[model samples]
Target: MVRQILPISALLLGSALLLFAGGMNVLILPMRGTFEGFSAASLGLLGSGWAVGYVLGCVFMARLVARVGHIRSFSVMAAFAAIAVLLSLLILTPWAWVPLRALSGFCFAGAAMIVESWLGERAEPQSRGRIFGIYTMVNLAASTAGQLVLTLGDTTGIVFFVLPAIFYCLALVPTAISSSASPRPLARVSLDLRALWRNSPVAVFAVFCIGISNGAFGTLSAVYANEVGLHLTAVALFASLPVLAGALSQVPIGLVSDRMDRRLVLVLVAVLALVADLAFIFLRPDGRLENLVMASVFGAAIYAMYPIIIAHANDHAAEGSAIQVSGGLLMVFGLGSIAGPMAAGYSMAAFGQTGLFVTSAVAHVLIILFGAIRMSMRAPVHEAEKAAFVTVPQGRMATPETHVLAASPEEAEEIIAAEEDRLAEEGTGPAHEAAAAATAAVAAATERPPRVSEEEP
Candidate 1:
C-alpha cells in the first residue's frame, strides 16, 4: 500500500490543498456575509450562482482541458479560484460576491476534475480500490480540517479570505511541478431527463429532492448556526459534524442496501432525514451540544441517500451504461441544487433562521412521499439482481470521474450480465418484465446525438 501510494503522493497533496481552500471558502463566505448584514436571500443567491457555475464547469471544462492540456488547465483554474476569493475580500458587497463565488465554483470544479483525472490515469487496476479509498479519506480530512481552522482566526476580516487564497495558490504547486504526462480529457456532463426517468423514476425524482435538501443545508447551515447564536467554534462544528457523521454512516448503509430493495433503503433514510428536519425547525436548539447532536443525526440520514439512489438506478440500467446513468443523474441533481439555495434563502429572509430547515423539510417530505409510493408500486429487485452499493462523497464535491473510480466499465458489464442471468433463471415476473422494458427504453432514449464528447487535448 505504501509503495502504491508513494507514486501518487503529489496528486494527493494537491487535492488536499485544493479541497482545504474550497472548504474554507464555502464556510467563510456565509459567515462573513451575515456579519456584513447581507440578507439571507442574497446569501442564497451566492449558493445558486455557485451551483450554476459548477454545472457549467462539468459541461465545459473538458473542452478547456482538451485545448490547453491538464497541467495548464489546472494551473489556470487554481489562479482564477485564488483571484475570486481575493476579490471577494476586497469588494465586501453581496452583489459583487455572488459572481465571484460563481467563478470560484467553476474553477474549483475544473481543478478538481483535473486532479482526479490524473489520479485515475496513474492508478493500476489491482490497486485502484485502495487508491480511491485513500484519496477519499485524505480529502474528507482536509476539508474538515479547513472548516475547523476557522476556530483559530476571526472570520470578519481579510485574514480568513487571505488564508484560503494562499492555500488555493499552493494547490497549484505540486501539480505544476510534477513531470507526469497529462491524462485523457475529462468526462463530459450530460442530462437526458426522459432516459433517466425511464431507467428509474424513483432514482430520478429522489435525487432531485436530495439535491434540494442537501444544497440548502450546505449553503446556509453556517448562517443558521451563527444566527442561532453559536460561537465561532460551535458554528464550525455545526457545519462539519454532519458531513463527518454522514461519511461514517455509509458503511452500514451500503451493506444493507446491497442485500435488499434499495428503494426501501432510500425511503428509510429519507424518513430519518425528515425527522431531523422537523427537529431542527421545531426544537430550534440554542445550546451548542444540542445543535451538534441534531446536526449529526441529520447528516447521517441525508448524506447516505445519494449512493442508495445511484445503486438503485444502476440495478435497472442496461449493461455498459453506468457512466451515463450516473452522470445524467448528477446533472439532474445540479439543476435541483441551483433552485434549492434560492428557495431556502428566501424562506429564511421571510421567516427566521429555522426557516432553512423548514425548506429542507419540504424537500425531504417530497422524497419520502415519492419513495414510499414508488416502493409500493414496484417489487424489490431480487438480491441477486441488485448492483452492489458503493459509497459516494457528498453531492457538491462529486464529479463524473468519481463514478469511473467507483466502478470500471468491465466491472459494470459483469454486474449487468450476472443480474440478467439470474433474472433469466428465476423467470420474469411483472416487476422483472417492467424493469426489462425500462432498460430497453433507456437504451433507445440515450441513442440520441451525444450532448458532448471528449476530444484530444
Candidate 2:
C-alpha cells in the first residue's frame, strides 16, 4: 500500500504547486497588461494567444510525451514555462507578451497532462473516488492561494511576474527526485465530430457556446473590474471569488442534473447565465458588496455549465465511447475559447468596456434560443443518474477512474465477465482471496492422511 501511494502523493504535491502558479499568472495578466500600456483590444489578443496555444497543446502534447518520456517532458516544459514568465517580466511589451503567453499556455497544458497522467497511473479502482476528491480539493486550494498571492505583492512592479516563475520552479521539486516509475504512454483522444454530433447535438453545440461565453468573461472580467475603478486587490478578489463560488455551486447543480432531464437543467442554467449577463450589462453595479455577490452568483452559473455539458454528453454517448465524446466536446470548447476573447475584446474596444458583458449576453441569447429549440426536437440521451461533481486529477498514472471506458454496454459486460473468468482460472476470488485460500488449506490438512513416506515405511 505504501509503495503504491508514495509516488501518487508526490505527483499530487507537484500538481498542486503548479496549479498555484497557474492561478497566480491568470489573475496577474490583466493587471500586467494594463500597466504595460496595452489597450483592451491587445489584452484580448493576449488571451486569444493563450487559448489557441492551450488547445493546440492539449491536442499534441501527448505526442511530445511519447517522444521524450514523462520526466524529461515534465522537466523541459517546467523550465520553458518559467522562462516564458521571465521573458514577460523583462520585455514588458504587449506584442512580446502575446507569444510569451502562448508559450506559457503550451507549457501549462503539457505539465498538467504530465501530472494528470501520473495520477491516472497510480490510482486504484477502490481508491479513485477519494483520490479524485483529494485532487479537486488541492486544485481548489492551490488556485485560491495563487489568486490571493497578488494581494501580498504589488502588480505595479515587474517582480510580480517572477512570482509565478518561482512557484512554477517550486512545482518541479516534488517530482524531480521521486522514485516513481515513468507513466506509460498517454492515450490520445481523437476528435470524431460526426459521431459526437450524432450522439448529442445539443451537447456538442452548447459546449462551443459555453466556451466562448466563459472565455470572454475570464479574459476580460479583470479589465472590466479595473475600468469600474476597483482597487487592484479588490479586482483580484472579485475575479477569484466567482471561480470559487462556481466550484462550490457545482455540487447542487450536479445533483439536480442527475435527477431530471439534463437538457432541462441546461436550459435552466442558460437562463440563469442570461440573467447574469443582463445584470452585468444593465445594472453595472458600482463597487459595492452587493456587486460582489452578484458577480459570485453569476460566475457560479457560467463556470458550472462546462462540466454539466460534459456529463450530459456522456449520458448519451455510446457506453464505451465516453472519452472520445468528452474529448470531442473539450476540443469544441477550446475552439470557442480561442474565438471568444478576440471578439469580445474588439467589441469592448469599439463599444466601450460594457461591451464585454454585451458580448457575453449576446452569446447567451443565442444559447437560450438554441436550447429552447432543441428542447422540442431531441429526446433524452440516456437515463439520468444522480449528478456528482467527482473531480479526478489528470495525472500521468493510469488510475482506473480516469481511463476511457468501452463504448457499449455489451463491451462493458463482456470485459467484466472476462475478468471474472480470469480470476476463476487463477483460483482466486475477488477481495479476501488470500484469507479464503488459508482457510481452504486448513480443511485440506484435516482431510489428508497422516504424513507418511513410502521410502521411510
Candidate 3:
C-alpha cells in the first residue's frame, strides 16, 4: 500500500490542501458575515451564487481543461480562487461578495476536476480503488480539520480569511511540480434529464429534494448556530460533527440499502431527516450538546440519501450509462442547491434560527410522500442487477471527475471501455460514464466490515 501510494502521494497532498483551504473558506464566510450583521437572506444568496457557479463549473469546466491543459487551467483557477478570497475580505458588502463567491465556486470545481483527472490517469488498475479510497479520506479529513481550525481562534477575523487564501495557493505546489504528465480531457457532464427521469423518477425527484435540504443546511448551519447563541467553539462543532457522523453512518446505511429496496431505505432516511428537522424546529435545543446531537443526526440522514439515489438510478440505467445517470442527478442536485440556501434564508428571515430546518423539513416531507408512493408504484430493482453503492465525499461540492474517481472496480473497467468507445465514435457519443464507486458504498454493497485488505486501504 505504501509503495503504491508513494508514486501519487503528491496528488493526494494537493487534494488535501485544496480541501483544507475550502473547508475553512466555506464556514468562515457565513460566520464572519453573521458577526458583521449580514442578514440571513444575504448569507443565503452567497450560497445560491456558489451553487450556481458550481453547477456551471461541473457542466462546463471540462471543456476549458481540454482547451488549455490541466496544469495551466488548474493554476489559473487556483490563482483566481485565492484572489477571490482576498477580494471578498476587502469588499465585505453582500452584493460584491456574491459574484466573487460564484467565481470561487467556478474555480474550485475546475481545479478539483483537474486534480481528479490527474489521479484518474496516474492510478494503475491494480491500485485504483485503494488509491481513490485514500484520496477520499485525505480530502475529507482535511476539510474537517479546516473547519476545526476555527476553534483555535476567533472565527470572525481577517486572519482566518488570510489563512485559507494561503492554503489555496499552497494546494498547487504538489501537482504543478509533479513529473506525471497531464491526462486526457476531463470527463464532461452530459445531462439527459428525460433519460434520467425515465431511468428513475424517484432519483430525479429525490435528489432535487436532497439538494435543497442539504444545500440549505450546508450554507446556513453557521448562520443558524450564530442566531441560536452558540459560542464559536460550539459553532465549529455544529459545522463539523454532521460531516463526521454522515461519513460513519453511510457504511451501515449503504448496507441496509443493499439488503432491501433502496427506495424503502430512502423513505426511512427521509423520515429520519424529517424527525431531525422537527426536533430542531420544536425541541429548540438551547444547550450546545443537544444542538450538536441533532446536527449530527440531520447530517447523517441527509448525506446518506445521495448515494442510495445514485445507486438506485444506475440500477435502471442502460448499459454503460452510469455516468449520465450519476451526472444528471448531480446536476439536479446542484439546481436544488441553488434554490436551497435562498429559500432557507427567506424562511429564517420570516421565522427564526430553527427556520433552517423548516426548509429541510419540507423537502423531507416531499421525499417521504414521493418515496412511499414510488415504492408502491414500481417494483424494486433486483439486488443482483443493481450497481453497487459507494459513499461519496460530496456535501460541499462534487464535480464530474470526483464521480469518475469514485467508480467501483467493475464499473471502472466498464468506464475505460466506454472511454474507448467514446473515442472510436469520434466524440459524438455520450461522454464517459464515471459512475461513482466510492469507499463506504462498496464495503456496504459487499456486506463486509471495513478491514485493511487489498480492496481497502
lDDT of each: 0.83, 0.70, 0.83
Candidate 2 residues lying further than 4 Å off, grouped into runs, are: 1-7, 382-457
The residue-by-residue lDDT of candidate 2 on 1-457, one tens digit each, is 4565564788888988888888788778888888777888888877788887777777788678655667878888888989998888888788898898888878887787777666654555445555556667777788878877888878888766888898899888887887766653444555778998898888888888887788888888888888888877778777778777877877788887787777788888878988877887888888657667888887888877877777777777664566666667777877787788888899889977788888878877777787788879976654534223342222111122233221122322333333333334444333224322322332232232222223321
Q: Order of candidates by TM-score, top first?
A: 3, 1, 2
- Across residues 1-457, which tens digit of lDDT does each residue of candidate 1 receive? 8899999999999999998988899999999999999999999989988988888888899778766677888999999999999999999999999899889889988988888877765766666677788888888889988999989988987888999999999999999999865654466667999999999999999888888888888999999999999999999999999988888899899999898788888888988998998898888889999999999999999889998999999999987777789989988888888889999999999889988988889988888889889888988898898876878888355887787666653553333344344435545555445433433332232232211112211
Give the worst 10-residue stretch by lDDT in candidate 1. Answer: 448-457
lDDT of 2: 0.70
* TM-score, per-candidate, Cα-based: 0.89, 0.84, 0.91
Please, what's the RMSD in Å of model 3?
7.3
Model 3, residue pairs in steric clash? 389-441, 390-441, 391-441, 406-437, 407-437, 408-437
The weakest ten consecutive residues by lDDT in model 3 span 432-441
In candidate 1, position 222 carries an lDDT of 96
Root-mean-square deviation of each candidate, in angstroms?
Answer: 9.6, 9.7, 7.3
